[model samples]
Target chain A: MTQQISTMTATETVIQAENVNIYYGSNLAVRNVFLDIPPRQITAFIGPSGCGKSTILRCFNRLNDLIEGFRLQGRITYHNHNLYAKDIDPVSVRRHIGMVFQKPNPFPKTIYDNVAYGPRVNNYEGNLDELVESSLRRAALWDEVKDKLGENGFSLSGGQQQRLSIARTIAVDPEVLLMDEPCSALDPIATLKIEELMKDLKEKYTIIIVTHNMQQAARVSDMTAFFNAEATAEQGGKVGYLVEFDETTKIFTQPSQEATQDYVSGRFG
Target chain B: MIPAAQPQKSVDLGDLKIDHSSRRSLFTIAMTILASACMLLTLIPLIAVLTYVFLQGFRRFNLPLLTQLPPPPGLTEGGIANAILGTLIVVGIAAIISVPFGVLAAVFLAEFGKGNPLARWVRFATNVLSGVPSIVAGVFAYGLLVKTGLTGYSAIAGGVALSVLMLPTIIRTTDEALQIVPKEVRMASVGLGASNYQTILKIVLPAAVPSIITGVTLAIARAAGETAPLIFTALNSSFWPGGVLEPISSLSVLVYNFATVPYEPQKQLAWAGALILVLMVLMTSIAARLATRQKTY
Candidate 1:
């Protein structure tokens, strides 16, 4: 749909994954997934619950490293650098690629301090006031929160807190943003606001979202990857795998794969 | 012959309301009454003890009771000033020794060692230590600090014993406070590229500070009232503490000794000492609650 605006011009591929397989201890949760994420665009992973959509997104910034049994066999390239190389530090990768969680999780702090937490940790040396103001403004939360920056972040409504969370991410000047079901915890209005914010943010940062809401993927994503789970033979357990990935319009309108088509049409049992 | 089904009467299901009086259970009433009786039983003793103690002790409340040394066998003009100072000194040192150790140990358990076998072992050890008697702690400290002739029968020795008593409670409560902090908050900090240590120091510690302080204060109050531990470690002196290295006159030991004396004045002095100790503990507890009650943001 945006072929007229910027697709005609060359844009660098920001991230690429090859032969990705995720395992939690002995369980092979996902296998043989290949994908590419583009810069200054929004890509979404859509799947049923427990289909490893979140697992894949977490792999981007290496958040899954926090889990005890989590491991992945894959080569993910970011900015032409090996993301999981021996010398590559996941911490720095996370600094460059920030994340927003499923829920609106602001710190137990004032709005101003919540936004400033990111920059302060990374040793931000510029005018912090300006950074805080601009970050909140960019996230479309400044006007609402400008009056009481000292109030607790939780005092804001759910949507506002989500925006505050976004403001915190962007303050660190991350090149990419990963969101794992950011709107699932929100009401329709709050979800709509976050969708709008995602679109606005894509002009400056590459955005990736995981959503169970197919309509959400159709609405905000430029590209969508649909994942499905099948019963494993060993213990009658289910394992998730990617089925189809394409332009959002194509996936929603006329998916080449039967599973994608059924999912998009709300006909999958 | 084929039989047709008869039409049934239309029930107004939406308007249906059962009479609750008929559904009420006598068993529920009995259980509720039993629970309330148990609760009252618990409260009655607490209230009775507190009331009796205050009534007996507050009568001796006066400026001299707090400001001067214990009077002679027949005279009742002096106070438990040295004992009060000694109690404060012992508890203060104990808190200073234990708070940092306990809080850091809790942080290690709650943050880095979560669900690890070592963490489980640490938690089990903490529970076991809490169950160890305070007099046993005094015995342990006496053997370590006094029997070894390091600082024999001194306030420092008493502090070491009190620290052992306070350590497990502080660690357990601090761990509880840190655990109450949602995992998502820690993830948020780490996702911001803060190292685990940084996340713990900047985010987790600040959020747990109020509860940590409360735990430490409660431990201090409990340590202040312990008499057996003081008898074992500090061993009680009649005069003011010469230094932290010397034997000190603590309120609990004074009460224990003077309460058994034949002299009326000594007994009265013991009562006054008990009252002062209770007030100190009460004030510490109140301060702790107030500290935790305030909203951080």
Candidate 2:
């Protein structure tokens, strides 16, 4: 019924994946992923366990390149620059596109140093103290840590450490932020705080979060992508494929695919 | 009295409870006693040795015990300070030679060398090296350094021997410590765009530092106590160890040399040297154990 609404407006598509397939050694891990991630939007990848949702999320910044046998047959472009092109340095790509892991994997440094690490390594010439303060403030962690910035990063509680990791990622002034279930290791209250922080973050950065919790995707993401696996004899096991991609509200309400319909209704993942 | 027939009152099967006691039995008590007895049995020799050394050594303790050289035969007035200084200098040199190679080898095995044939071979060599007699290490160093004309029966030669003995221990322990550093920590660093070198140097190595220090300290202690390696390499000198290139008298070697002599004063000095050596090793090992208690996270 909508006449002239393009799925992704011209200015919106910051990252576009064209026919993506990932492999680990000989196993086709994920297949046939065609998606466009809008800039300054919180996009969530929601799926069941071991569906390679995390695997696909890692590919956005070529984080998957670190894996021993990881291979991708896909054209993933960041603002139309081929990320996998031989000339494109993966380290610089990762520098511009930061990531927060599922665990609160802070470096064994003081809280201040943890946040300052990225900026330092990338040779950020700006005032470090101000940057650390502002980043921590943005992550809702400054007030709690201001007096004890020299303490080890692990001295903080689980949620605080997760926030510290986010601060660390943002301190580098990245164009895109990748969060792999950043709240899974946190308590419910902490998860709520992270979700709220995600909402505020979209004002300045594009964020792609991979989440196992369906409600989290519904609550925070502007758009949602669902992935599912199907057994294939040729592949010799189940390999993940993107099942649905749409506005979060629509995907949760009136999804076009039967699998999406079943998933949102909690019938099956 | 008539158990089977009487319990037909349904036995209240749901009300019946199985024993969940965690209490120890007679067998457990007996085993604990046996283990303690076995431990005490082994400790008997240790206590006897320590007590004997202390009894003989304490009577000769004076300011000169740390300030003067050993006395001539029949004279019981001086101390083995030359040997003490010699031991420190030789062990220090060994640590200097061993630590860098051990730490680097460990880093390679833990980071880049996992499952690689060359690393596996090196690790295997280290294991074999750990098992080799310290005297053999001394003989090898004697042939390589002393006979080969690099340095003859010198402290540096002794250090090389001790380094050979210490390298395997340091490498194995450091490798184990590095392996325990969570992969996520490394991934976190690399994910932040740090290169492999940066991630390992700034993150992985620092995280593994405490445990590595413990291993390095223990390796030093072990090298400090080694007597056989020094015999073929360092030999013995009554004078203060001049430098790494000169013949050195380590406490272990001095004890070996004195204990075999027929003189009474020399025997007493040997007892004192033995005491100092044991205490030095004991202190270093305790410090290492404490360092190991620091959390890797």
Question: Which candidate leads in DockQ?
Answer: 2
The candidate scoring highest on lDDT is 2
The fraction of correct interface contacts reproduced by each prediction comes to 0.65, 0.67
Q: Give the Cα error of residue A190 in candidate 2, in Å.
A: 0.6
Chain B TM-scores, listed for every candidate in order, come to: 0.89, 0.91
* Candidate 1 per-residue C-alpha lDDT over A55-122 given as tens digits, one digit per residue, 9 for 90 to 100: 88888898889988998898888987878889989889999999999988999889999999999999
- Write model 2 residue lDDT over B1-297, tens digit each, in one string: 224445548453432443334354566778889999999999999999889888988877778888999988788788899999999999998999999999999999989996699998999999999999999999999999999989998999999999999999899988998888998888788878899999889998999898898999999999999999999899999998788888999999999989999999898888889889988999999999899888575
Docking level of model 2: medium
> Residue B156 in candidate 2 has what lDDT?
95
State the lDDT of candidate 1 residue by residue for B1-297, as single tens digits: 222333573444532444444435566777899999999999998888778778878887888877888886777678889999999999988988999999999999998886699999999999999999899999999999999999998999999999999999999989999988888888889999898898888888888888888899899989999998889788888787799999998999999999999998888788878878888899989989987895342
DockQ for every prediction shown: 0.61, 0.76
Clashing pairs in 1: none
TM-score of the A chain in candidate 2? Answer: 0.96
Task: Report the CA-based lDDT of candidate 1 relative to the real structure.
Answer: 0.87
Lowest-scoring 10 consecutive residues by lDDT in candidate 1 chain B? B1-10
Which pairs clash (backbone N, Cα, C closer than 3 Å) in model 2? none
Candidate 1: misplaced stretches above 4 Å? A1-11, B1-25, B291-297
